[model samples]
Target: MPRRCTRNRRLVLVVLFVAALFVPALANAEPAVWVVKGPHATVYLFGTIHALQKDDPWRSPKIDAAIQQSQTLWLEIPNVDDSASMQPLIMQLGMDQAHPLSTKLTPDQLAKLTRAANSVGLPGGEAMFESFKPWLAALTLSIAPLMQAGYDPSTGVEMELKPEFVKANKPVKGFETAEQQMRYFADMPEKTQIDFLSSELDDFDSAIEKFKQMLAAWSAGDVDALDKLNNADFRDKYPELFQILVVKRNQKFTTQIEDLLKGDSVSFVAIGAGHLVGKDGVPAMLEKQGYKVTRE
Candidate 1:
């Protein structure tokens, strides 16, 4: 199965709470960073990978410097780690016991899902995931492999960075609230959600491998490679999802960054690496708006 399905989820969902946490900076790592300057404000844009193994190093001195220079940090959400607040929302929007997975998926898909569940050490049994809405099920399946592969969300960039911001008395803002982020998936048409689940099922076995490829590209600061490897196939296979999850969100974020630039404060904006690359990425959008955007 192609890794496109998994790639799509990793790019966006990882930024939400789907993927796990952070590690020290690797001397050789240079994930892409962009400097966007407005007349009065300067914003540093850095792409982030949400889940990473303990051995992985992504923070570079440039990023460190940017963090020091900025008065505020901006992420996809301000409270990504607040599971207590998220659980109720998930229960309300992500469960559908009355409908059940058996009713929505084909026999073949159910079988694949079963195998995927077992591989990830999830409870065995056909009904194990029956109560999950298709989108939630897909996210569950996608996240398990990453965790099994030793990816920790507790160590992800935001997890590591949020604390420093708090200690410094720097405000950490978000492009959206966690509820809005969740609704992006929960509000999808059932057919689209099912298709997302099916694709995830097809790509289950390659989840870790695909993520490694993406991580490599990110670490190398190869935006072109990252774009082709992560965004292209996903955009082609699921255009609507790509638009909703990536493009539209980037557009909004770009606008927000632009507005931030009009102020005198320096801000560092970190988001999913996938949103920092490609034509519709936040950096590109800002460049088109006549801001001085320089790759660092």
Candidate 2:
């Protein structure tokens, strides 16, 4: 196994924790935002790209107004920016030295993985990946290309929005903890994790192009296209991942929004754009519960 030096380990943390989860978008973006109106509560459901290039204008007047009106902010997880708190947890959950990837992947697959890693600038090459669990490897590989293409995770939507709320002393909450979110991948069966990694590696060559398409669709606020581009293939290819990562989480998010409607405060909820489109998305589920969900 390759040595887990400080630089490479920090790279893993950045890729897995920050850059890889959400898609990215471009400037002058309309992107999607839904206003769920209840008798006493108003919750803004805004779709967010986790990483963005410098000067990507993802905000609009409507979005700015909503932020001002809201008293609380909701994100997938609030602790994402707290790397010191999250690093040890990531190490515990994402590493599996006892089960080297060499034993799980065939020699041919290993060779391809090495190539894919190098192509994207992942550190340590084939030997270093030995301790990485399949899910971690897949995430690291998927985002490396985008990072190389100039996406900056530090400027992501969550990163940008969090500070304003903190300075204002407004409460920011999460649908789940960071540990719970990571467990969605870490708890998968070994075979399932390998399959997930293999699928990502198989598509390594076109990941950037796919991301660009997503960027265009999301920037244009094309929910239908987003559904097709982001959800369809993954749902068909890895139903378990689709169920666990998307469907169930959307359900949980919708439920949380519904609970918020039972109260009397305004809240801004920003999550990955993929979770807000499609029929199984949070917006659709909220509509089914008799809330007036208006796309703004």
Residue 114, model 2, lDDT: 90
lDDT by residue (tens digit), candidate 2, 1-296: 35545545554446434422356666677888899988899999998778888877888888999999999999988865776676676689888879898889988779889998777666667776898888878777767787789886767888888898999999989888878877888899988888888988888899888988888888888999989998899899999878988899899999999999989999999888888989999999998988889988
Positional deviation of residue 193's Cα in model 1 after best superposition, in angstroms: 0.5
Candidate 1 local lDDT, 156-178, one digit each (tens): 78878899999999999998898
Q: What is the lDDT of residue 141 in candidate 2?
A: 74
lDDT, model 2: 0.82
TM-score of 2: 0.94
Instruction: Report RMSD for candidate 1.
Output: 5.7
Candidate 2: worst-modelled 10 consecutive residues by lDDT: 12-21
Residue 119 lDDT (model 1): 78
- My TM-score estimates for the predictions, one after another, are 0.91, 0.94
Which predicted model would earn the best TM-score? Answer: 2
lDDT computed for candidate 1 = 0.78
